[model samples]
Target: MPLRAEGLGKTFRSARGAAVRALDGIDLSIAPGEFVSILGPSGCGKSTLLAILAGLDKATQGAAVVGGKPVTAPLVDAGVMFQRDLLLDWHTCEDNILMQFKMRGQPTAPHRDRARELLALVGMESAAQRYPRELSGGMRQRVAICRALVHEPPLLFLDEPFGALDALTRENLNTELAALTAHSGATVVFVTHGIDEAVFLGDRAVVMSARPGRIIADVRIDLPHPRGAHIRELPEFTAYTARLRKLLAHDGRPDHREGVRP
Candidate 1:
């Protein structure tokens, strides 16, 4: 169930009839049940690579394979979540989560039990009847996460899922997400701009270059899993963050959004 990319590249026809290369010769592999974070500057095509891997779009060149099968179109073997929760405005939390089941054509009875279990896992059983408008940003994101996992796909692609939350809530949710992934034993490909977040959650972190994107550095985070919040206070954490800062700053502009509070 590994995700593999070989000589992956992407291009687009611009409005003016010029070809623009977004990703360039990217090569990487993510093992089953591993957590890998892709970090880079805003326009570096990190999201583009993610889209190709999730089979949302076709790669202009090279290959991407998941679970030993070539990815042609959107594959059901993986799940994707983005920064926006994308919850239905009027649907109750549980109903919104159920939509995932409907999309995948999964049987209702088993997933119904699974959905309620996920809600309980996220400690949101109390809010199961609430609408998105009634929940706080953090709670809504939690519900979104529950929706993402309802189908129990082996691989999950998260594109800055915590990017919009407040500092405290984001930190708390990071802890929750790490624990949830551990319990589920699902492989993850997480995209983030926060070095601390990457260091905390990733088993391996892939840093990409500026436009005409390519992988520049691949650092393995040797930290033990169930990486508790307390680990952030240790020297290893500080050193790891400092190293990432140095790498991100190598090109004059760092790999991050300015004024990012999370």
Candidate 2:
């Protein structure tokens, strides 16, 4: 589940037939089982880079390799979660999770236990039979997480999965996600705009620049795993957040002078 991008670049043609660069000279390597958070501004190519890495889109100038193979199409071994829950209103929660296997033309019975386990992990066990319309926003998102993980994919790509939730709900889910995936041995690439969220959950925070995006910094989060909400109050946690904030404030012009405060 290791991922590598070599000299990756992407460009698009505007509606008016103008060329617009979205990414450039991006060289990044993520080790297996590492959780890397991608942090950037709104218009930066974070989502675009993620799409290319996940093989949903092709890089215009370089290559993306996953698990020792060139990514030519969508990866079957990877699981993706987006900002919205995307659950079907008619399907029950457990059935929503089971749909992953159904879509892959795989047997659902064999994966039922795992689906239930994931639901219990996110405190949704009792709601397994509930439809999406009956669940709260956070509960719906928990089901989405279970759906993404029930297949036990070796790689997970999350694009602002908690961005739509309120602050308290987001923080609670952050803690749950850390605990859920702590030992899953999955290489996770999480894209988010929250510095604290990145620091709390990532083994490394990969900061990106503005449009025509490029990596500005790859910061190592030295905090212990199984991080809880209280960990955010620790000085080390604040230091990491501060460093990331400074890097982002530069808007792609990282201050090399600012060393790791932790």
lDDT of 1 at 98: 88
lDDT of 2 by residue, 31-135 (tens): 999999999988789888889999999999989999888899999878999898899999999999999999999899998888988899888899988999998
Error of 1 at 261 (Å): 39
TM-score of each: 0.93, 0.94
Location of the lowest summed lDDT over 10 successive residues in candidate 1 = 249-258
lDDT of each: 0.88, 0.91
Q: Any residue pairs clashing in model 2, and if so which? A: none
Candidate whose TM-score is highest: 2
Lowest lDDT sum, 10 consecutive residues, model 2, at 253-262
User: In lDDT terms, how accurate is model 2?
Assistant: 0.91
